[model samples]
Target: MINAFMQARTGSTRLPNKVLKNLQGLPMFIQQAKRVQRAKLVDNLVIVTSTDESDDIIEQLCNENNLLCFRGSLSNVLSRYFHAELNYPCDAIVRITADCPVIDPELMDYVINSHLKNNNDYTSNCLVATYPDGLDIEVISKNALHNAYKYAEKPSELEHVTPYITSHPDKYRLQNIQSEQDLSAYRWTVDEPKDFELISSIYENLYVKKPNFNYQDILELLSHKPELNLLNPQIARNEGMVKSLKKDKEEGYE
Candidate 1:
């Protein structure tokens, strides 16, 4: 079974108790989990939180929803993920954050299908699609995760999560599924106050009577109201390391 495992905790330094923050009468973490389960691509979905004291609320929410949940080290996320893969019956694991409210299930299916079709060990939508924020998806074989658990030695790898597995192109066959329709300017993931505000706007406008619709339905609604993209102009970018490396090169550090 392919598992979409979400890593979440209340220890977020930037926004404390952000996951417990309500999005239309529902906790943000729970809402994100529901979206993952609703996705057509994921065979099974599990919320992976930490054993830290702050994550108690996450554990309770998981129990109430009857969703599979795992708790492990707060900092060493790679180990937490590996433990989840071992406990769950997952052949491949999809790494998803608990902050994405507008995660595209169709795009997730595309990434998983592309990985298996191309016989790649690692695949992701963020590698190429660049569809704003909420559409990020990463699929990696269980073996690759185990390899990361054992071999990844850097503190950044333990903290920031899956980069070690994807960075080694020689060891893992990495593939990216690009969006053919060109919807790269959309924002859906929740990070800061502005991100949460943007996602709340989408939920307010789209998820009124029917809170459960696939990605295509979302696109149809969003296309008709193109101004929603302006809800948050500064879209989040996951290219921090790349940007830092470029700066280093300019400063003669590389």
Candidate 2:
């Protein structure tokens, strides 16, 4: 089964409980899932979260919304995903994060189709990233995930949950989906206060008018009002991953 395994937690230091924040009346997590559910290629949508007490609310939210939920290790996310696939019948595990409420379902189907057509061990939009940060997508075959679990042991690999497979590109048949335009400069992920402001503003301006808005709708909105980009342009891409990599070296997690 093709499962979109969304990773989330309530322990974000930069933006505490950001997943639960309201986006057009629904929590950002729920809103993101609502969009993901529309992907025709995805067989099931599941929330893969941590087992920490703080994350119990995530499971509760998933229960209320009728989303399949799985709780595992807090820090070792790679292992969590590996086991999630084991317990659930996930053939193609579509990796998603809860922070991206602007996720496009058609784009998700494109990524999944690419994975199947290429017969790749692992495929993602992030490898050569043409999409904005929050729109990241990763589709890993069951074999690829099993291999990652068997070989990856570094703290950053465990924490980031795909660094192992992504790092060892030579070992895995990796495919990167890219857009014709290099739109990498855009930042749509929610990691800080400014990010939340940016996302909330986007929802306020677009959600009510077009409940199922896609990338074009957002592009048009931003084209008319470029000021939205300034809300969090200062933040770098994968700031959390960079920090984890640095901390791993200092704390002897290598």
Candidate 3:
């Protein structure tokens, strides 16, 4: 089975309850789940969250939407994915985040197909970041995931799932799916208030006409109204991961 797991929590320091925030009249994560469910290649879809009380809201969102949910470690996200794998057995795993409400299911299937065809231990579209940050997708063999769970020790590696696997490319076969054009400058992720503004505007402009709007539609919208890009350009990409890594180093971590 190929289980697609999306990790969510309500404890984001920068944007608390961002996942549950309303978008197009529904919680943001639910919108993301709807997009992910359109994947033609994935066999199962699961929302993985933490056991913290704050995350209970996430679980309830999954329940109300009738989507599969798993609750695990609050901080150790690698552990959460591992447990989610155990709950819904699968030979390969697709890792996604709740913060990305605009993820493309077609791009997801492309990554999944490439991962299997190349027989890669791990694969992703963001390895070199050709796609926009929010559309990132990662696929890994179950055996490789087990190795990451057993060996990853650094707090950053454990908390940011797939870092342990990608950091050590020499230990695993890796592949990156790149876009024909370099559109990495666009930031569609919902991490801060400005991000939500841009995303909400995108949904407002396109969701009504095309409920299944894809990346191309977003690019067209941004092209037509270039001012939309200004909404969240100030926020750096992967700010949370950068903060975690910096914190680890400040505390005397190597």
Candidate 4:
């Protein structure tokens, strides 16, 4: 079975409870979860969050929505993922983040199909980042995830799962699914207030008309109103990973 695990928490420093922020009367994470459920390749979807008291509300939300959830480490997200897989074993795991409220289901199925067809140990569109930041997706084999859990030591590797597998390419087969056109410049992730505003605007414009809006729909919207990109202009992608790398260097894990 292919299980999609969404990493979530309410402890975001840039925007606390950002996942709980509403879009079309549903929390941003729920909206993303609902979209992920539409993927034909995914057999199960689980919301993986930390076991901190701050994340209690996340668990409560999962219960209220009847969504599957797993609670684990607060800082060590790799450990969280590893344990989540231990409890809910699957053939391969799909890693997603809660910050992406506008993630496309069709795009998810495409990458997952590639991963299974190629027999890759790891597969992702963001390996080269041809797609938008929020639409990033990763598929890792069960064995690869186990190796990462057992061997990863750096702060970055522990905080951001799959870095260990990507770093040691010789140990595992990796594949990257790319888009026909490079749309990497577009930012659809929610990390800060401005990001939230941009995503809110996207939902307001698209969600009511067609609830299952894809990345193409978003691109069309941007083509018409180019100024929407200005809402969260020039924000660096993977800022959290950069911060974790900084911590790794400080701790002599580099």
The best candidate in terms of TM-score: 4
Per-residue lDDT of model 4, residues 157-220, tens digit only:
9999999999998999999998899989889999989999999999999999999988899999
Task: Give per-residue CA lDDT, model 2, range 35-61, as digits (tens).
Answer: 999999999998999999999999999
The local distance difference test score of model 2 is: 0.90
C-alpha TM-score for every candidate: 0.87, 0.97, 0.97, 0.99
Worst 10 residues of 2 by lDDT: 245-254
Local error of candidate 3 at residue 203 (angstroms): 0.3
Model 1, CA-based lDDT: 0.79
* Model 3, position 16: C-alpha lDDT score: 86
Q: Tell me the whole-model lDDT of each prediction, alpha carbons only.
A: 0.79, 0.90, 0.92, 0.94
Candidate 1: where is the Cα deviation over 4 Å?
216-227, 239-254
Query: Where does candidate 2 stray beyond 4 Å?
Result: 251-254
Better-scoring candidate (lDDT), 2 or 4 = 4
Candidate 1, residues 1-254: lDDT per residue as tens digits? 68999988887655677888898889998877777776676889889999998898898989998989999888788889999888996778999888787776766888888888887789988776556567888898988888888987666566556778777888989987777666677767665777787778778877786787666776777788877667677755654345544654665653
Better of 2 and 4 by TM-score: 4
Order of the predicted models by lDDT, top scorer first: 4, 3, 2, 1
lDDT minimum window of 10 residues, candidate 4: 245-254
Q: Give candidate 1's error at residue 209 in angstroms.
A: 3.5
Off by over 4 Å in 3: none
Query: Which ten residues in a row are the worst by lDDT in model 3?
Result: 245-254
